[model samples]
Target: MEETVANFSGSNGPDNISGTPGADFIIGLDGNDTLFGLGGHDRIVGSGGLDFLVGGDGLDTIFGEDGDDTIQGSAGADRLSGGTGADRIFGGDDGDLVFGDEGNDTIGGDDGNDTLNAGDGDDRVLGGDGDDEMFGGGNADLLRGGLGNDLAFGETGNDTVFGDAGNDRLKGNEGDDSVNGGTGNDSIFGDEGHDTLRGDDGNDKIWGGDNNDVLYGEGGQDILWGNDGTDSLSGGDGNDQAYGGGGSDSLYGDAGDDSLYGDAGNDQLFAGDGNDLAFGGAGDDFFQGHDGNDTLKGQDGNDTMFGGTGLDLLLGGAGNDTLAGNEDADLLRGEAGDDDLNGGSGDDYLNGGTGEDQVTGGAGNDSIYGEEDADRLVGGDGDDFVRGGAGDDVVLGNEGNDTLRGDDGNDALIGGADDDMLSGGNGNDELQGGDGDDTLLGGDGNDTLSGGEGNNELTGGEGADQFNFDGGITTIVDLDLDLDVLDTSSVLGLDTALSILGSTTVVGADLDILGGDGSLLTLKDVTILDFADFLGIDIDLLNSDLGIISG
Candidate 1:
């Protein structure tokens, strides 16, 4: 065994010292010295100044103490440390343990599965091209896993971590950080402050821990969670799963068919370009669906949702929500609370479940139902089917051949254009049929039926029924004329009957008795006995309150 100590000072030329092949000791002190332990369980030390320490062919220990240093453990199971100053430490060829104890250091495990620990200051640690483990101890650090399945931890301060190619686990334990899980199915965590995490190209699991964070699931079917604070997450390409956990967060399902959730706080979710399903679990949230057929639910709080350019399903689950189906065929449900629902430009279906609501069938053939409370429903242009479920409702079938029903509750129903059917089902209702020959059926209770401005049919079913005649062109047929009344208040210009026979037509004369428009009336299913009150009089005197013809 041999021992040698070589000291070089005063900014001189570098000194290179080596030991014998047996167990030996070599040390270099100051002034850019190089220390080498060439064989047999040797120990080499480089203390102060720019130094280099190398351990060769043995289970040796090497240390580069202070100033910019480089320490390499070559060809043996070695221990290498760069203690203080900006240093570079390499664990070469064997399973070695390496450390960059201080300063901003760059540390790598060259071959063998090794452990690289970057203890403090801003540092870079790489499990170099092997299935190794690395730790970023403190300060802002960069921890990368190379070519193998690795485990990386960014313990504190702002850090950047990459799981370069294999299945790796990257954890950012504290401070605002950036993490990338590259290529493999990795698991990543941003433990505390605001963070940015990417599950790049793998079916990875990425979690944004605390504070406001941003996460991206870039390729495979990944799972991302924005655990706290207001965060933004995107499922970039595959059919991924994302969640906004508490805080006001934003989640996007981009490209693939995805499932997203807003668990709490007021959040926003976008189902971008793919058929996706999104749920707004609590708080006030907003949801948007673009291009593909998607399904969205605003589960609680006052939320708004828009289904843009796709045949989507939108649900306003609770609280007062607004849902709009912007393009293709859609289905919308306002489950609880007072809601406003719009079906834009497609054949849509809308239901207002409870509370006072308003629904519009915008530009397509839509079916709208007011399932509870007082609701207002408008069937915009197409042949729509609109029905009012419970509370006092108002329904309007604006265009095309449509059907409007006010089921239960005191409702008002209007069939606006084209040949349509309007039914006031139960309760004291008001039904008005406008334009192109409609059928107005007032089902029950003290109902008022007006057949407005068209050759229409009016059938008043039960209770004190009032058949109103504006006389544009109308037909009033009371099954039991002995129990129904013909309201002649606005029918002052009504005509004397052209003919009246049993179960035959009673056509209009349009006689200008009083001052209203000269319109026609066809009273069917009645005999002359039904009109006994104005019998044998001129058509000018048809202005009396004819109550059931005094049966």
Candidate 2:
């Protein structure tokens, strides 16, 4: 047992101490005591019994006069003080300064670069490492900046802030606050109520003050600003930029080369890649150009548009409308409402002027024209051209090498591939031809034909009749009747057999006028005979392995 109380003054003895070591100057003349500065550089003082103080190394100074005290600065460079009750303080190494002067305190600046303050009730502050700065002076506080490059502040109640690594800065000064910038290169600010901001990596900057706010820019090259209420902004990668400054806002440019602006109310914009540009400056807005080579503008209220890839340009200036150009080489216009248009890929150009409109050309090589209401047109892919000008209409040319014309309604025409031509000029009509080499003309209903490939020549002129062929060719003639009247139902179903007996009527002898009922007969001249009882049915049929019919 050892005790050396140098210059120890006592007004009321036994302020509770078990101290008997060298170089000790413990002073607590009043009721509180538990002062152990057992090693060198020890100067401990607790003028009341709610105190336990230890400054075991050089450069130490500890003091807690009233109740509620625990001060620990076990190494050099320490100075802690919670002179009033309700205090717990720690500054264990070099560069320490802690003060929780009034009640409700837990303050720790546990290593070098430490300075902490929680002076009022409901306070918790930690700035434990180098480059640390923390201040939560009033009630309702919790602040942390535990690594290098740290600065945190939640000076009033209803506060929680953390800027845990290098390049950190956080602020949530009043109530309704929460902030985090937990990685390198961070900057966060939500200075008033209704605040939440996160910018967690290098190149981070976020600001969302005033009511109704939320902001996030979680990676490098980040800058998010939703400075007013009704805000949400996200630009979480490199080449990021987002600004939705007023109420009624939502902005996202989540990949590289992003620039989004919806500066006024009634706003929504998304352009998440390189070569992106979106602007919906005033109210009533919706815009999406979600890939490269995009330009969208819906500057006033009553607007909706989407042009999601390269070669995209959409503009819907006034109210009442819908427009889409979801792939390359697109241009859409609905400068006023009562409009709907889609040109979803390369080689697309669509226009639907004045109210009452609908237009579609959803693949490459497309062009559609439907200028008024009561309109519908479909021409999707290369070699498509559709024109349905006035109201009451339906027009389709669904594949390459197609041309369909239906100038007025009560109309339907389908000619969907190469070598196709369909025209139904006036009302009351239905026509179909969906493959190569097709031409169908039925300007009034009660019309039907199925000849969808080459060598298809059909004419079903006036309503009441039906003619069909899977193997095409039909002809019948009687010039006088001779050459043995060509037996076997006219030259034995001639797949190649033409016999004109006399008057030198046998032209290279190759004919098949199918009496075998395979139904393909067109023998114009059985070797040039305007003579021999003119009973002509040699019907020239040459199938020398199906070649040489080029015209």
Candidate 3:
């Protein structure tokens, strides 16, 4: 039964006491008691058994001093503490200080600038308003910093922490924990064990300290650091910057123009949307720029990068890397080490920098450079421009009207199909125009130029070069009569140079080969006497068909 008390001192039995509107004092000194401080500044204490205490109005002080208790500071700026046993505490109105001392407890600072200390045991605390500070003490706890600028620390144990709706600072100190920075600009840390940290809104800063961890920058322009261990970090929205420090980590820039750094170990970095930048530092890493114009750098190991969609720039620094510009006009540089690069679709620029590398310009008009070492460059479709710089390189213009340049070393340049231009710059190089009305330039050294099919134009720039002609109308320009020779071994079935001179017939200014299945070799600015003097043979011996003529 409920009893009205001016000063109630109960026995070792269950008691219910209510206080008057004036200044009152009530103490339920033993059994499970129920006390209410209805008005004025009152003091209520449940000194022994399991009790229910409520500070209903003005400035009040409520204590759950003994057994398991339920305490509520319902109105004014009150001070409440759940002492000893497991308790549920709520500071329901003004600025209050709530203590969940001993045993496992649940605390709620429902309004005002509250201070909640979940001392000892596994506790759960929610700091509901004003600028609040919460501490999750002992065991695994869940702390929510609700509203206002709050501070939350999951001290010890594996805890779960949330900085909800305020500019807050949250830390999961020690154990493997999960922390979220919700709403306003916040700072979060997962200190020690493997943790999961998320920056759910506003421009926040998150760190996953020690062990293997995962972090997500869910909104705003945030910064995330996955320090130590093999970690995974994602920048979920806005222009965020994420760093994967140490171990083999994975970093994702999920939206906006983000920057992701895979610092150390073999990592995977993805720039998902917006114009992003990603760095694969140390170890062999993988990077993908899924949409937007991104820039990806593979700084130390043998990394692989793909520019999926927009115009991206990929740099493979220091390792044998593989880079693919998956769509649009992108730029890829395989700087140092032996690398492989592909410019998929769009007009891209690819540089196979240093070591022996392989590069392909897939579709669109791309520009490919095989810089240093013996590299292979293929311009696949569209009108591409390919340069094989230094070493014994191979350059292939796979399709369209492409241009292939073999710069230095004994390089081979091939125009795969259509009308392409092949230049063998320096060294004893080989140039082949596979189809269409192609142009082949054998630049410097003892070079060989072959017009594979269609009506081709072949130019031998310097040194003693050889020009091979086949079934089509082959036009030879700047061909030295004394130093360069025409190779008609495939058309005339004659391997020796004397047999080629004996099988040529000059019809006007062109030398017609009779046994090439109607193949015509057009020698520009050269007559029958000029060809005969260069061959150092009788002019009639070169003019005679020897029963191998048509028409």
Candidate 4:
């Protein structure tokens, strides 16, 4: 290692040459050579064969033109290349441009914001620090766009990639491999394996290329797709949008107001938080709206869905599905098939759009509508409004003040708690008002009305109707004794006719003192177990009446 100008112009053999002290130029011509640029700002070239080039200091350029070569840029802003063969190139210290051209290679743009190019074959490239750009050309390659906001290209073949820091983009053109969008808002693509990709931070968009893949949007708002095959996707935080493009896939909106879709196949989706929108298009899908206000739909197949929290809206588009609104005010619809829908709490709206469905409004004020088929609806608590449309149906207003309507067909409407309203529109129906002051109307059928307690009004419209009374004050306002019958089984414990009172009709305002709950059965009909039985009299007449009869 002395001060000299050593230039091997025709060293056709494998040569080992070293440059020293001064500004030296060491060149290796042909054969496999070892060229070291030690002191001065040196220029070392491994012209041919499998060569090793080392740039010691100062601004240097080392070219491994042929064969599988290794080049190390020790302490300078260097330009290193493994020209043709499978090579290893290292950029030490300062900014460097390292390229592994042609064969399978490994290139590292160590420190600084350097450029790393892995030209051909299956290669691995890394950008150490600062802003780096990694170019992966053809073949299966591993490219890491390291530190700072970096950019990496996994151009062609099955490759593995990592975008470590800052805002970066890692694109896998083809093949099955794993990729990570380390931090910052980064975009990553699983261009083709059943690949695995993660967008670690910042709002990022990731796409999975044809085949089964796993994708994760770790934090921030992200967009992910399980493009094909049976894939899995997770939207970790912030608002995210995920779509299961095809096949039987699973999508999860872990947090934030995220929107998720199970595009095809038998899929599953979880809308974690924030107001989210989810649609499971086609096939039997399972969807759950975990928290926040969410909109979910199981487009086809016999699906099962749950509206987990907040005010949620769920639709079971087709097939027989089991849909439930776990908490808060929710709107649940079982669009088709013989379905079941349950609204868990708060004020909820439930619609059994079609098919023979069983629906329940768990708590709070609820509105339930059974559009078609023989449906069953029950309102759990609070004042509820229930409508049973078409077919023979049964509806119950379980608690609080409620309103129930039997639109068509032979239907049964039962009211529970507080004051309630029950209406039987057509067909032979039954309307039973359980407690408090209630109103029961038999619209246009040979219907039966029963008022359980408190003051109530019952109307039998256009038919041979029958009225049953249990207790309290019940007013049979529109009871045509010519076409209607009063069944007082509640007092007599058996059916008894209106003639039992014997024409002594006590009109509303002309009422006098009667025993029991101080009740006036009605201005017209006072049927059922009357106060006369409690007073130990078979006939009804007051002591003030002149020809009053006593049993």
Candidate 5:
């Protein structure tokens, strides 16, 4: 067990040799051996045996070959390799190049910048300090880039990789792998197979390259992309950006302001807290803005989106999409295709931008607009204002004291069971007052106003307008005496000219036309003598249709 001063060589049997203080070269050949180059720049080789080799000082090179070996580069910049068998290799100080060549091995780059490779077999490797580069081979491996800025790759097999500290780049290349960027800004890639990747701290960028992968950005602002297959990604904190590149993927922005893009396939994105922006780029996708004011766009295909807990903007970009604003005041736009939009709660704005869309203001006082084509706009609850901007649209005031307008084309404005106002702005439109006392305004062109079951006021602004009544007291104002007509064909009495003339009476300053079923139509600011020529009682048609009135 005594130390040797000269460069020594071991025999084929088990031997122990320790070298000189100056630069020493020690070789262990065959059998199990222990070789130590104790000082200065040294070269130590354990050839063809299960051995323990150590390069103690200065810049050294140590190699453990042909058997299970333990190789240590104890000081200075060194080169170490455990070759051929299950080995444990360590680079103790300064910069080093360490390799675990074969079998299940454990390699550690203890200090300084190093390059470590776990070549073949299942291995465990760590880059202890300084900036380091580590590589894992074809079997299950555990690779850690510890401290400083580092780079690591888990190549093939199911591997676990960690970028422990400082800024690092980590990749899980093949098979099902797990990768974590423990601290500092990092970049992680789940390259192949179904993998799990996490950005534990600082701002990080992560990519799920192929197959179905799971990714998380645990802290700081992060960028995550689910590149292929069906993947799941979560941005745990800070403002983040997430992309679902292909296949059906799920992305979550757990906190802070976030933006999520569903690029292709049917993806689901949740912007959890913060004011976020989300886009369903292609294919049918789903989006949820869990909190804060968010903007969600269904860019293509049929997408469904929900804006939760804040003022949100939801757009149905293309295909037959569906959008809903779940809470607070929101804006919903059906941009293209036939879309359905709902403003779930609070005061909201809903616009059916194009194609035949269906828009609903779910609660609170809301403003709904049917922008183009034939759309159906509904004011779900509270006092709402609705406008059918173009095409033959249907505007319904569902509840409360609502206002509905038909801006263009032959639209239908229905006041559903509330004290409402219906306006026909242009073209030949139909306005129906469903229940409570309502007001109808025919702005231009020929229009039909029907006061369904309540006392109503009708104003025919221009063109030949028709007023239809169903019970209750109805008043007609701004009626062009010679152009507007009242169809009283549904009356029980007033079938003959004598009976129709007897029912016409002057009630206060208004001219009242009475029906047999206790219904009355009042012509405001007109005398019975002046309106008699506009009535059809004195004329008889060729078909003996007594209700025909020529205006």
Candidate 6:
């Protein structure tokens, strides 16, 4: 039968009202009341005071009406809804459904994996710590997958969905989604729009779909993909792999042995720790091998590279390039175009082929060679060897035992640190030995020599000579000796005549010497000197010095 009950007075609820079919409103006097809908789909409303309603047996509808009410659905697949005011709805036994409408409400699935929906406002939906399903609808909602694998959906607005310590599936749908894969292998998806997905402390798989997304694989070896658009991917700890699929992207393999790829467009790749490999697939690129042994290649376009630590190899192919080996032992080669190479630390080797280039070995035992064109070379530290193969070049040995040579063209050479050897092979050159015992030669052309430290040997051969020895002894040995008897006067001029007389004095003899009017004079001893003075000097200095000049 169809029955209707209405109360004008705002009372709590009617104490103990039981009905079958028809819509019912059981009102209570300012006290708590209990109502049950036994048959047919019925709506029961309790106004003002606290009340309790149960939709029992049939497909009944029970509302917790107004005041703080407790509603339950016992048996039968019924729908229990809670009214405005703080209320509690329970799906007791059976696969029942419950919705806590408006006001702050608590909804739980008592038995049989039930569906609990919290409608409007802030609400709490619990799957009653069972293998149940909960939905936090509208406003700020909290859904907990207490036990068992539960599917929790945070619809619209901002929501907190937790797979609380179990293998659960949580999705942050629409609005801004915050999901935590608490203590279990959970699958979380931040679908559509801008979202934040974190694989918190597990081997989790996360997808930051569309828009600009931030995906963080917090711990463990996690897989994260930035699908479409520009995205930020970080593989936090563990050996992680990251990919920047499209757009200008940033990928960081924070620690452990990580592999990073910049696929298409100009992208930035950072392989932060462990032995790492970085690739700048296309376009102009920048790469940093922050730590561990690394391999960097400037695959295309003009690129700049830094080999940060450990032994590294850098190849600059095509385009003009700049390579710096920041620390540790490294090998650098400029394959094409004019390039600049610097070996910053450890024992380094640099080869610049073709094009005019500049190369420096910043520290450690370094070897540098220039293949063609004019080039600049610096052997920075440790025992170093430098060769300027062709064209006019400038080579400097900054420190340590060094060997420097100007192979061709007019070259400038500076020898620094420890004992060093320098050769100004061809062309007019300048050679300086900054410190340590050094040997320098101006092999060709007019060259200048500065002997920096220790005893130095210098030669200004076949050219006008100037020699400076700021420290240590310098001995000038005449390499051009007049062994030709026919050309004695040309070799032994006034200077040679005085040198001969000084040599005789060293043997405890005093000899007075005089020069004849443009005629060569040789004073062998006192007897030969007096006889030669009386004969008026000239029987040819070559013959007299050779003992052919006799009194």
Better of 3 and 5 by lDDT: 3
Q: After superposition, how far is residue 374 of candidate 4 from its true place, in Å?
A: 3.1
Show the lowest summed lDDT stretch of 10 residues, model 4.
493-502
Question: In candidate 5, which residue pairs get closer than 3 Å at backbone N, Cα or C atoms, i.e. clash?
Answer: none
- Residue ranges of candidate 1 with Cα displaced over 4 Å: 1-15, 479-481, 494-551
Q: Which of candidates 4 and 5 is the stronger one according to lDDT? A: 5
**Cα lDDT of model 1 by residue, 284-308, tens digit:** 9999898799999998899999998
Instruction: Quantify how close model 5 is to the true structure by its C-alpha RMSD in Å.
Output: 5.1
- lDDT of model number 1: 0.84
Score every model by TM-score: 0.89, 0.46, 0.85, 0.78, 0.89, 0.59
Candidate 6 C-alpha lDDT tens digits along 1-551? 34443322234435777765544444444557777766545555555567877766655566666678888877766677787777888887766677887888888876667778888868888776556777787877877777666788878767777767566777777666667666566677766556667767666666665666777777777676666667777878877767666666677778877777666556677778888777666656677888888777766667788888888878776667888998798998876768899999889989877778899998889989877778899998789999887888899998888999887787889997788888887777778888887878777766667666565666655565444435454433322222100112232223323112111221334333333333233333221232332212355643354333333
Q: Least accurate stretch of 10 residues (summed lDDT) in model 5?
A: 494-503
Number of clashes in every candidate structure?
A: 0, 21, 0, 4, 0, 5
**Which parts of model 4 are misplaced by more than 4 Å?**
1-33, 36-51, 54-68, 73-86, 91-104, 110-122, 129-141, 147-150, 155-158, 416-419, 434-438, 452-456, 469-474, 488-551
TM-score of 4: 0.78
Give the best candidate by TM-score: 1
* lDDT for position 55 in model 6: 68
Taken over the whole model, the C-alpha lDDT of each candidate is: 0.84, 0.68, 0.85, 0.82, 0.85, 0.69
For candidate 2, write residues 494-526 as lDDT tens digits. 342222222333366534334433433333445
Where does model 5 exceed 4 Å of error? Answer: 1-6, 489-551
Off by over 4 Å in 3: 1-9, 15-27, 35-45, 54-62, 74-78, 478-482, 493-551
In model 6, where do residues sit more than 4 Å from their true spots? 1-140, 192-194, 227-232, 245-252, 262-273, 280-291, 294-324, 331-341, 349-358, 367-376, 385-396, 402-551
lDDT of 5: 0.85
Please say which candidate is ahead in TM-score: 2 or 3.
3
The C-alpha local distance difference test score for the whole of candidate 2 amounts to 0.68
